[model samples]
Target: MSAEPLVADHAHEVSDHGHDPHATTTGLSHIKLAMWVFLGSECLLFGGLISTYLLYKTRGNGRTLPTDVFDIPFTSVSSFVLLMSSLTMVLALSAVSRGEAEAGRTWLLATALLGGVFVGGQVYEFTAFVREGVAFTTNPASSAFFTLTGFHGVHVSLGIVMLMSLFVASVKGKLTQRNAETVEIVGLYWHFVDIVWIFIFTVIYLIPAD
Candidate 1:
């Protein structure tokens, strides 16, 4: 019967519909769309690399062919490490969703460290290959192999940088529960890159050449 109570009840009803004037846009949707666009472009870039690899798979000289030089066990372990990083990435997103900022930051840092390990493995592998007479200019196979894997390594390094920045921002209170959606979007991109490696590893290391 009171005017003030009537207005308060109407205000509560509107708030339930999420019709607040101060409502912030959930940026996850835009971030996801941007990521998709980026990945689409990356597909073309990687498609070129893969085509080159196939074109050169059988053209190497007396140097180590893929089957000859691929250390399957070592690469398999590295592949698993990269895959586990994806799991850590998802855990980071989950932590942010649960408003556990510390846990989220921890997982993000773990993911970056794992990524660094993967990159280090790649560097060692490439160095060993070079020492074994697989110079980039020695043959098409060497060139293609180095080019494809090197490109992927660069991407992984960039991802690690982003993850570190995210973790630091979280530490400084720049990234907060309110930005959980942003964290989820970054995790989505990181996971996509990891999955792409599955196909890359299969083609580059597992499949037999004709």
Candidate 2:
């Protein structure tokens, strides 16, 4: 019944929980948890935008129906590029996790390049749409369409900026495994953007306009 024996038993009990003494008590990294919360809020935001678009979609004047202006083939190619960027992002994360800094940076650059291509395609599409009388002020349908898709384009652009920043950090030796969690967090955002695009593409472009 010595106090020393009681203290030893308490220490053993604490260690039995398999908790890392140096890790956060919540068992998840704080940054990742924050990212999840941010993404969740984004889901609500995007959901509202999509609902608005769907509601106004059928309100377009005959001159600006989606079918008349949407370039499916061009969008298909852009979608493919964005989807492949997700793959490259995974590769980049894998490389970083494995401590292959050069390969990780290379893959990151590739991901960013592909994202750029997708954004460029979107810009071209938007310009073409404007030239064909699909301005944001043209009608309710056009406004909703521009708002929803423009928001997505801005997200992609921001993701590209993040990727480029990560690449620069990697080159500066600031992206070691000790802080590789940063890259993983950014990757999560990138993947989320790509997934959102999949939904948008299917809903806005692939389905036949009514």
Report clashes for each candidate as comma-separated counts: 0, 0
Per-residue CA lDDT of candidate 2, range 53-163, in tens? 988887877667555799999999999999999999999999999999999999999999999999999889999999998888888888999999999999999999999
TM-score of each: 0.84, 0.88
lDDT of each: 0.82, 0.86
Instruction: Please name the candidate that would achieve the greatest TM-score relative to the true structure.
Output: 2
What is the number of residue pairs that collide in model 1? Answer: 0
Candidate 1, TM-score vs. the true structure? 0.84
Candidate 2: list runs displaced more than 4 Å.
1-22
lDDT of 1 by residue, 122-177 (tens): 99898888887777787888898899999999989989999999999999987877
Clashing pairs in 1: none
lDDT of 2 at 141: 89
* Best lDDT among the predictions, by candidate number: 2
